[model samples]
Structures are given as structure tokens and as C-alpha cells.
Target chain A: MSADLLIELIGVGKSFPKVSRASDRLRALTSLLLGRSPGRVSNVLEGIDLTIHRGQSVGLIGENGAGKSTLLKVITGVYSASTGSVRRLGTIAPLLELGAGFHPEQSGRENLRTNALLLGMSPAELAASEADIIAFADIGDYIDEPVKHYSSGMVVRLGFAVIAALKPDLLITDEVLAVGDESFQKKCVRWMERYLADGGTLVLVSHSMYHIQKLCQHAIWLDRGRIRKQGDVFDVTQDYLAWHEKKSADTGIEHRLTANGEYAVLRFALNGDTGTLPIELPLGEDLLVDVELRGRDDRAPVFGIGFKRVDGTAVYGTGSEFERQPAKRLAHGHFAWRLRFPKPSLLPGTYVITAHALDPEGVRLFDDLPRTVIVRGRTPELGLVRLAHVWEDPT
Target chain B: MNLLISLLAHFVQREIRERFLGTVSGGAWLLIGPLLTLAAYLFVFAEVMKVRLHADAGDSFVVFLALGLWPWFAFSESILRGTTAIRQNAALIGKIALDRQLLVQAAVLSAFLIHGLGFVLVLIVLKLSGYALNLAGLPWVLLGLAGLALTAYGLALALAAAAVFLRDIESVLAQVLMLGMLLTPIFFPPSQIPARFAWFVSFNPLAVWIGCIRGGLLERGLPDASGLVLAGGVAIAALLIGRFVFRRAAPHFEDYL
Candidate 1:
């Protein structure tokens, strides 16, 4: 292995022995003693091939029970792989869970010493950083109390403080950021940013796409104990979110409607594509909606467009009638309108575009057509649309 | 190697502290408990039964029993605690990845360290009481105790690993150790047993260990070279078998635990 290669896994897999009954345990023990695989086993991960180089920040995104935690354990050597090989180099600090190595009966101070030593710090090294760790934790007087007496927030504070002081070559954290209060979470995020800037490697697992996009340069999506996709952070996370949107849309109520009555939509197209499939557009790109409606009695119908998130949250809506512009007359009973959003300021996610056709008065709804639009890009901003803003210098 | 040694030291310290954490008198009970047991044994055998040994003319029954009792406590207690070491720390084992053998070794080492200090205090008391002990044979007695400790550690390692798979080992071992103590001739000399059963004393490895220590302290002269050789062989064999079983079972402990 090269010195710069922090972790490497080739076709690695892990399985646990299934020993629900007393006889199964006996059989498993006997087989293990005799140098054989257990009689019955359940595989948690399969054919996982991953390589993480030094100074590389990677994010692991997956739903629950997708074997993300098991993969992390295998990388950290907590669980030996049942097949293939795993090789890791350098000092690794894994915050696998809350209070994992802590003794409930021991004081926080004592647990810190044990945990620091277990992370491969020498006695002298631990002594030097002891004060810095306590200060970072900032839990006065509670440090002397038993860990069982601490609140859950206090426990995570102490845990993160120890890891921060250690400054390991590689840091692996699993969903630990959600437990701390707002200030501490900010402190941890700032520390991690500095750590990464200083050439420290990181492998983070989180459900929040904002955090993943902010911290990681690469991402891997695991689905059903296998790597579904792995590549650039933007590409993989976008694909994962699109997959979730499609899944929920399948079980959601149908919105497609057949044309009926007067003022019905005769044809609709987004970006010149009239097909039923959703359209993918990059952020800050222009969106054009074209619709042709049928009007009775030769009166032009009003065309309106509405934008919403995949979860039915309205983002923006406007109609030609609101702007005092009438639809263009075409042939005998046909009317058409073209709506353009110049450089739409929408965040990266799936959104639905609904077109409405009304009578000339724009009071009664006549027809509705819905189409899906996926905005693709990577940004740490929250919410649906990016509001215009400017930050003035304090000086 | 340095890491392993440091980890072992930390675990041994924790094990000793855990033993007396909740007690009021704390460490004082270490010496006081053994002294009280000695007092009760003296009352029962020396006063009530009037037991005497034919092998030693000058030493009382209390002196003869004291020589063997403390070593037996160290040996038996080490096995008992070591057997439960893995099961007791299941929480730590399931979370952090470290050397599992250290847990068992720490338990055994702490037991011997505690009882060894008590054994030294007993020897000091015997010397101050005007007993004609062959103090020059102290090195041989120490060697005998070291051999017994090695044997106990070997058995502890094997039993501790097995106990992870078989919960019954802890309960069953208590009965077996009690029966073993009675069969080792700790209270009675080998000469008291019938001629037909004399072979039982000769075949018992613990009997050879107690005899070696008693010979050095009671002025029976240095232990015979053949008996020392026999004890050394058994200790080494037990250690090898214990290590073999422990290594095979260590990797699967997490699955079963």
C-alpha cells in the first residue's frame, strides 16, 4: 500500500452468524473452533470496493438498514470482513455512536483518559491536550460527575472534544452532529472545516444533503447493502435525491388529467420537449413554458403557470392576466401563450410546474396540466428558492 | 508491544479498583478477610478436633494450613474472576476493538497481586511469632508460587473464552473448584490417606505445588529436582493448551457475546 492511501477495500463483505436458539450458538461455536464458517449467516454488506486517499473528504449517504454503519465498522476494524480484504493505514478516530466506549459508572474525566489512550495517544500526548479537551467541551463541574449523570448533549460534547484534540490522520463520524445544540454544532462544523483545510481526511455519514454537500468532495450512495452510485458529490447526491422523489411520487396521488370542456389545454411543452418525462435543468438557467388552449365563442383564455416543490409546497405562481397581457389569437378557437422565467433562482431539487387555463376573465379554473422539473446543482443554501441578498462589509 | 503493556497496566489497575469500589473499609478488607478465615480454621481444627500432622514435629496445624491456604486463595480466585471477565465487559467488547486477552490476563494478575501481598504479610507474622522457619528456602517458595500462578492463568484463559459460549461454565466451575480443593490434601497430609488411594495425591498437580512450598518453609530442605521438573512441565503444558483454546475462541467472542 502507498503511504498516501489511508483506506482500501477490495470486494469486502461482512456477515453475522444467526444464532437465535441455544443449539444454534453451540453449533456456531463448534464450527468457529474447527476453523469453519458458521452454519447460518446473514450478509450485511457485499462486494464493497472503496479507496480513500489522504486528505480526501468522502460522504456516505444511505437510508436506514442500508449497511452504512456496518461498512464504517468494517473500515475501522471493529468487525472483520467475512470475505475479501481491507487495508487501512495511519491513525483513525471513529466516533461510531454516542458514548460508545464510555463507562457509565466512571466520571467523564476518567472516561476521557481511557478513550484517549484507546485512540492511540501516548500518556504524554494525552497530558498535553487534557486541558484543551476540557475547555472545548466547556461542561464545567459536570466533567467530574459520572457519565450516567450527564445529559445526552453533554456526552456528545465530551466525545467530540476528545476527537478534536487528538487531531488524528483520519476522522470518521456517523450521524453524531444531530445531538448537539446549535452553538456546539457550529463549533464542530468550524473545527471540521479547519481540520479538512489542514489536510486531514474525513468520512462522514449523514441524511442531511446540505451538510454532505458542504463538507464532502465525493459521495457514495448505498442501496440495499450495495453501492448504488459513487462519484462526484454533486452527481451522486442529486441522483439519490431524484430516486427518492420518484419513489414517493409513485405512491403519491396521481395529478395527470385528461382534456375536457372549453378553455382546456390542447398542448403543453417545457423547453421544447412535449413528452411526458420530467426535464432536467441546471440552476440559474432560464425556464420557458409553452401552452395552447382551446377557447369557445372565440374568446381567448387566460394562461397561468405555478411552481411547487415535489412535496406540494408552492414556490411561485403568476398568470398573464395578472400582468394585463392577453393570449395571442390563433386560427378559429385556439389561443396560445408563452411564459419565460429569466434565470430562475431555484435551489437544486425536484419541482413541479402546473399550467392552468381559465376563461377570458381569469376567475373560474378550466383546465390544469402538471409537469416535473428537476433543478440540478450543488449548494449549501436551504429552502426552495434563493432570495436575492447582499452582505455589506463591517469595516 | 509497548501499547499492549500499557493497555494491560491500565486494565489491571481498573480491575483492582473495581473489586473494592463500594465497600466501606475498602482495601483493608483484603487482609482482614483472609485473617478472619485463618482464625476460624484454627478454632475448628486446632481446638475442636485436635488435629495434628505426623510429617512435621515442630509446626502446629495452623502454620501448616496457613502455608497452603493463601496460595490456594490466589490460584482459585484468579480462575473464578478470569472466567467471568469477558461476560462482565460485554459492553466494552461490543463497542471498541482491542486485545480481548488483556481482560482475562488483567483479572488473573490482579487476583494474584492482592493475595500475594497478603501472603507476604502472613510470612512476616510467622517470622515475628518465633517459628523456626527455613528462611533461606524463601527463593524456592517464591518459585513454587510463580509456577502455581502460571497454571492458574492458563486455566483461567481457557475457561474465560469458553464461558462466552457456555454460560453454565461459571456455575459448574464453582462446584469443580470446591471438589478440587478437598481432593488436594490441603488439610491432611498424604500419609493419612489409605494405601489404595495414595496415588490420587501423587497424581494431583496442585498437591505437588503445595508440597514444594511446604517443604521449603517447614525445614524439609530444598524441593526435589524431579518434583520441580514435574511442576514446571505441567505449568508449561497447561499454558500452551490454554493459549491454543483462547486464540481459537477469541475472534468469535463478539458474535456469541
Candidate 2:
């Protein structure tokens, strides 16, 4: 192992025996005693190959039941892998499930002492930092009171305070920031920023994309106990968010196909592609919508174009009637419209482009068609669309 | 190794504190409880039952019983507490990664420390009251107690691991310990048992330990070489086998727990 590499896991896998039944437990006990794999197991992680080097902050993002906690446990040595190997160097402080080892009957101070010792702090080191921990927690006299009387936030405060004092080589935290109050959250974030600035390695697991992108330079996305993506933080988080957007779009609302409407959309395409596949457009490029509409009578149909995120959030919408520009009449009762957006400043994400054919009065909706468009690029900017801005230096 | 020792000391302190927590008299109960049991047994055997030792015996019946009873309590109590140590700390086992054997060792150590202190106070009272005790044999008696503690620790390790998988071990262990106390020669002298059943006493390891201590303290003599060898063999064997079973079952304790 290189000295710079803090952790290395190659083909690591973990499985738990199905010991719900009495006979199964007995069988498992016998097999374990005989040094064999227990029969009938549920594999939680498989073929995980990863290496975390010194001074690298990596974020772990995954849905619920995606084995994020299990992988952390395996890395922290709380759970040994059922197969393959995991080699780790340097000290690690895992803030998994805050106050997990705290004895409720004991005082907060006493629990801190025990936890610090368990985290490999010597008695002298703990004694030296005891005051710092108490002050950092800032729970007042509650530190002397039994831990059972403490509120949940107080517990988290005490837990984080102890780890902060330890200053371990590698810090692995799992959603620890979601509990504390806003000011305390800011304090912890500031502390973590300083810790990272000091070249400490971190592995953070959180559902909040903002925190992941802020703290981590690299990210790994786990889906169903497997690594779906791993790369630069922006790219992985973008892919993760797009996947969630697509999932919600699949389940959120269904679009109605009005084939027999009076003013139906005969054809709707983005950049001359009339297929169901989503059009991949580069960021900052122009977007063109070609629509061919059919009307029942000799009335011109109004054309409306709109953009929405896959999650049904409207980004931009407009109608030709609002601008007093009518679509060119191709034939009797048939009209065609070509709308152009020159250099749209949309962010990289999945969006749905909808073309609507309304009555000439633009008050009654008649027919609408939706097409998917994916804006592909890499940037650290957030939100749906970018606004023109400039940063002025202090004079 | 230093960390292990430090952790063991912390756990032992915690175990001792937890044992006396919520009690009115707190730590005083450690000595008082055993002393009361001694008083009750003394009243029953020495007064009501009119029990007496052999005519040539140097010590009274109460002394003989006290010498045996205190050591037995230390050994049995340690084993009982050690057997349940893992289950009692299932919360910690599931959360943190530490040496699992430390829990069992701490449980046994705390039990012995408490009972050992009580035993020392009783011996002081007996000696101050002018009862005939071989003060020179006290070191041998201490050595005997240490041997019994090793055996208790070994059994506790194996039993504690097994109890995680088999809950019935806890209940069954209480019954077995009760039966074992009767079979051992704690209440009566070895000479009193019938000739046909003398082999049972010879094979019972606890009997050998109690007899060795009793002989050193009451008879003012060293333990026989054969009994010493047998006791030593049992203690070492129990330790090795117990450690083997414990290590094999420890990693999977989180799953079963």
C-alpha cells in the first residue's frame, strides 16, 4: 500500500445470514464454528473496488436501502466484509448514527470520556481536550446531567463535539448535519471547511446535493448496492439528480394525447428530429422547435411553446398570440411555426419541451405535445437557468 | 496491548458501577449482602442444626463453611455474570467495534473483585475474634482463588458467546450451578461422603479448588501435589477451549445480536 493512500478496498463484499428461524440460527452457528460460509445469505454489497487517498474528500450519494450505511460500516471496521479485502491506515472517526454508544444512564461528560476512549483517545489526551469538547458542544449544565434527559439535538451536539476534538485522519459522517439547529449547522460546516482546508480526508453521506457539492471534490453514486457512477463531483451529482428527475417524471403526471382534437398537432419536433428519443443539446446552444398544426376550419391556430423541468416545474413559457405574431399558413386549415431560442442560458439537466396548438383567440387550449430535451455540459452553477452577472473587485 | 488494558480497566470500572447503581446503600451492599448470607448460614448450621466438625478439628463448623462459601461465591457469581455479559451490552456490540472478550473479562473481574473484598473482611473478623486460622497459609488460599477465577473466566467466555445464539443457556446455567454447589464438598468434608461416590469429588474441578483452599486455611497445610496438578490442568484447558469458542463466535455476534 502506498503511504498516501488512506484506504483501499478491492472486490469487497458483505452478506448477512438469514437466521430468522431457529433451525437457521443453529445451522449458521455450526457453519461459522466450522469455518464455512453460512447457508442462505442476503448480499448487501458486492464487487466494490475503491481507494481513498490522503487529503481527498469524497461524497457518497444514494437512495434509501442503497447500502450506504453498510459500506461505511465496512470501512470503519464495524462490520467485516464477508468476501475480499479492506486495508486501512491512519486513524478514522466515524460519526455514524450519532450517540450510538452513549449510555443513557450515564452523564454526558462520562459518555464523552468513554466515547473518546473508544475512538482511541488516551486518558491524558481526553483530559486535555475535555474542556474544549464541553465548550464546543455548548449544552450548558446538561453536560453534567444524565444523557437520557438530553434532547436529541443535544446528543448530536455532544457527539459531534467529541469527534471534532479528536481530529482524526479520516472523517466519515452520515447525515449528521440534518439534526442540529441552523446556527449549529453553520458552525459544523465551518469546522468541516477548516478541517478540509487543513488537508484532512472526508467521506460524507448525505441526501442534500448542496452539501455534497460543497464539501466533496469527488462523488460516488450507489444504486441498489452497486456503484452506478463515480467521478468528478459535478458530473456524478448531476447524473444522480437527473436520474431522480426522470423517476419522478415517470410517476408524477401523464400527458394526454389528443389525436382527434379540432386543432391537433400534426407533427412536433426539436431540431428536425421527429422521434420519441430525447434530444441532447449542448449548453448555451440555440434550441429550435418545429411544429405543424392542423385546424378543422379556416381559422389560424395559435402556437404556444413552454419549457419545464422533468419534475413538472415550469422554467419558461410563451405564446405566439401574446406577441401578435401568427403562424404561417402552409395550406387550408394547416399552419406551421418555427420558433428559435438563440443561445438559451439553461442549466444542464433534463427538461420537457411542450408545443401547444390553441384556438386563434389563445384562450382555450386544444392540443399539446411534449418532447424531452437534455442539456449536457459541466459547471458548478445551480438552479434552472443562468442569469447574466459580473463580479466587481473591491477598489 | 496498552489500549486493550486501558479499555479493560474502563469496562471493569463501568461494570462495577452499574452493579451497584440505584441501590439505596450503593457499594456497601457488596459486602453486606454476602455477610448476611453468612450470618443466616451460621445460625442454621451452627445453632439450629447443631452441626459440628470432627472431634479433632481445630476450627468450628462456621469457619469451615466460611472458608469454602466465600470462594464458591466468587467463582459462581463471576461465571453467572460473565455468561450474560455479551447480551447485556448488545447495544454497544452492535454499534462499536471493540474486543468482544473484554466484556466477558470485565464482568468476571468485577464479580471477583467485589466478592474477594468481602472475603478478606470476613477473614479479618475471624482472625481478630481469636479463631484458629493458618495465617501463613493465606498466600496459598489467594493463589487458589486466582486459579478458580481463571476457570470462571474461561467458562464465562464460552458460555457468553453461546448464550448469544442460544437464549436457554442463561436459564440452564443457573440450574446447573445450583446442582454443582451440592455436588461439590463445600457444605461437608470429603471424608463424610460415602466411599462409592468419592470419585465424583475427585473429578469435580470446583471440589478440588475448594478443598485445596480449605486444606491450606483450616488444616494449616499445602494442597496435595495431585490436586494442585488437576486444578491447574482444568483451569488452563478451560481457558484455551473457551478462547477458541469465543473468537470463532465473536465476529458474527452483531448479526445474531
TM-score of chain A of each: 0.90, 0.92
List runs of model 1 lying over 4 Å from the truth.
A135-145, A175-190, A253-266, A292-304, A319-336, A356-369, A393-395, B44-52, B55-57, B194-197, B219-234
Q: Model 2's DockQ?
A: 0.65
The alpha-carbon deviation from the true structure for residue B37 of candidate 2, after best TM-score superposition, in angstroms, is 1.9
Best by TM-score: 2
Which interface RMSD does candidate 1 score?
1.4
State the local distance difference test value for candidate 2. Answer: 0.87
What is the CAPRI rating of model 1's predicted complex? medium
What lDDT tens digits, residue by residue, belong to model 2 across residues A1-395? 37799989999888877877777877887787888877888988988989999999999999999999989988988888889899989888998788888999888998898888888888889889999999999999999898999999999999999999999899999777778899889988889889999999999999988788888999999888888999998789988988989998899887765756688888998888999888888898998888998887868888888899999999999988888887789999999888889989899899999988888777778888899898878776788999999999979
The residue-by-residue lDDT of candidate 1 on B1-257, one tens digit each, is 77778778877887887677668989788778778988998898778887778656667777788888888888899999999999988888777767888888999999989888888888777778877678887876788788888999899988988898888899999899989888877776666777888877777778778877787888673446776787789899989978987888886777788
| Model 2 chain A poorest 10 in a row by lDDT | A252-261
After best superposition, candidate 2 residue A137: deviation in angstroms? 2.2
True contacts kept of each: 0.31, 0.46
Model 2 clash tally, residue pairs? 0
Error of 2 at A141 (Å): 3.3
